[model samples]
Target: MTSLETLLRNTQDVKVIDRSIDYNEYIPLDLSAFNPELSKFDIKCAVSFEEFIEKHLTLNDAKVAFGGYNEQRNLYQRSTVFKDEKTEERNIHIGLDLWIKARTPVLSALDGKVHSFNFNAGFGDYGPTIILEHQLENQIFYTLYGHLSLDSLKDLEIGTVFKKGEQFATLGNAAVNGDYSPHLHFQIIKNIAEKFGDYPGVCSKKELPFYLENCPDPNLLLKITA
Candidate 1:
C-alpha cells in the first residue's frame, strides 16, 4: 500500500476553505510561541485575536492566513482543556489552521462520507466538529473539520456524501467556536481508533510522537506552499 504521505503529496488542487479564494490570496501566519508579536497582545481574548488576524491579513495584502501544524503555541495556556495540575500542558498544535472571517465556506478535502459530528462545546474545544472517513489508495483514513458553525450541522447526517472541494460547513465565530478567533482547524488522521467527532488537536511534548504519527501535517493535503 502507498504511504499516506505520498498519496497526499500526489493529490492535487485540494482546498479546504473558500474555494473562490485562490491560494495566492493565502499567507503563512505564525501564532507559535516563537513569534514575538503574539506577546504584545492578549491572546486569550477572542475579539483581540480576531483583530490581530485581521491586521496580519491586511498587512500582508492577503485574504487568508494559514499555518500552525506542529507549532508550539502559548495561546493554549489560557484553557484548562490543555492543562491542569496533574497533566502536562498540550501546547503543540497538531493541525493546520486557516484564519479567516466567520461564515467562510469550509470544503471537503476529498470525496468522503460523514463519519461523525458533534458540538464539542467548551473553552478551547473544537466546537461544532465533523469527521469524515475516506478510502484512498486502498487505505482508510479520516479528516477532521473543527470550529465550524452550528448551522453547518443543522441537517447533516452520517453517510452524507461530499465530493472533493464541496462546501460542507462554514467557519464558526468565537461565540460558538471555543471562544477563539474564527478559523478552520483541519487535520488528517491515519488511525482514528475509537475517537468519534472529537480528536486531540494538541499534544504535550511526551505525547508528541504518538499524535504526530496518527495526525500528519494537514499541508500535505492542502498543498498551500505560500
Candidate 2:
C-alpha cells in the first residue's frame, strides 16, 4: 500500500490553475510581510485588494502568485472569522493561494466526487466553495477549492464525479470572492469530520500543530516549484 504523501509526491502534470500558466509564469508569494508581528506591510496603505495583487504580480514578474501554506498573514485582521473569542487569532494560512485573474478555470487535481459545496458569503469568506472526496490507493482524502465565482455552483450536485484535470469551477473577482483579489484557495484535508461544504482554512498559533498534522502542504500534490 502507498502512503498519501508518497502518492502525491509521485503524481505529475497536475495543475489547479488555468493550463496556460507554464512553469516560467508562476512564482511563490511570501505574505508573511503582511503579518504585523513579522513586518510592516500595512493593509491600510493598499487602496484595495486588486492594487495589492497588482503590486505583487509586478514585483514578481510572474503571471500567477502561489503559496501561503503555514504562512502567517496579517490580512485576516480585517475579518472577525479569525478573531472570534472561542479560538486564538487565526492568521496562519494553511492552503496554497493561486493569485490570478477572475474567471480562470479551476481544475481538479485528482479523480473525485463532489462531497459537498455551498456559497459561504461574508467580507472574507470563500464565496462559492467545493470539496471533493478522492481516493489514492488505500488512502482517502479530500480537496477544497475556495473563493470561486457564484456561477461555479450552478447545477452542481453531491456525488458528481470529475476526472483528474477536469474543470469544475472558476476563480471569482473581489466583488464576489470574499471581497479580495481573484485567487483559488486550494487545500487538502485528511479528515473533514462532520463539516459540510466548509472547513477551517486558517488557524491560530495555538492550533497550528493539529492543523499542520491534518492538512498537509498542498504543494505536496501540486508539485509546483517556486
Candidate 3:
C-alpha cells in the first residue's frame, strides 16, 4: 500500500485527479470573450500559471482584488467591489487552478466519502463544486474540486462514497462554469472543522500565514510538469 505522502512525492508515473488522463498537450482558453468582467479570473489564472512556471513563487505583500465578475471589473474604488474594503490587500488565491477546456474528467485524489456538494453560481463563481473527505492514520483532510458542469451536481447526494481514482465529474465551460475559462480549482484543507458544500478558496493577504498553514502547496502533491 502506497502512503499518501509517498503517492505525492512519487516521482514515478502517478495519476493526478485520480483518473484524469495525462493531459500532455493543453492550451488555455480565452474566457474574456464570454465575459469581460471575468477579466480578473483570467488574470488570476495567468498569474498562477506564471508562478507555476517559476516553480517556487510566493508573494507576501502582493495584492489581489477579491470579487467575482460576470462582465468586466467595475474598478470599484481600488479597494473593494461593493462593501468589503482592502486596497493594499489583494485577495490571495489559496487553490491551484488548472486552465483548459471543459468536460475533462474529474478524478478522485484518494478514496474518500463525498462530504458535500453544491452549485455556487454567479459570474466568476465555482458554478459547480464538490468536496471529498479523506482520512489516513487518524489525520483527516479534505479536497475541494470546483468549476464543474451543472449536470455534475444535479443528482449528487451527500455522504456518497468515492473510491480512490474514480472518475467523478467533468470540467465545465465559461457559460455554465461561472463565466470563465474551463478549469479546475483544486484545494486542500486541513481542518474543515464543520463545513458543508462550501469553503474559502481565496483569502485576503492579511490572513495569508494562517491560510498557508491550513492550505499547503497543492503542487507538493500535483508535481505538475509542462
TM-score leader? 1
lDDT score of residue 172 within candidate 1: 96
- Model 1 regions lying over 4 Å from their true place: none
lDDT tens per residue, model 3, 92-136: 567777654477678777778898988887655677999989876
Choose 1 or 3, whichever is better by lDDT: 1
lDDT for each residue of candidate 1 in 1-226, tens digit (9 for 90 to 100): 7999889889999999988898999999999899999988889899999999999999999999999999999999999999999999999999999999999999999999999999999999999999999988888999999999999999999999999999999999999999999999999999998998999999999999999999988888888982
TM-score of each: 0.98, 0.92, 0.68
CA lDDT of each candidate? 0.94, 0.86, 0.61
Q: Candidate 2: TM-score?
A: 0.92
Which residue pairs overlap in candidate 2's backbone? none
Alpha-carbon RMSD of each model:
0.9, 2.3, 9.3
Two-way TM-score contest, 1 vs 3, winner: 1
Can you write out model 2's per-residue Cα lDDT over 135-181, one digit (the tens) per residue?
A: 99889999999999999999999999999999999998877788777
Candidate 1 overall Cα lDDT vs. reference? 0.94
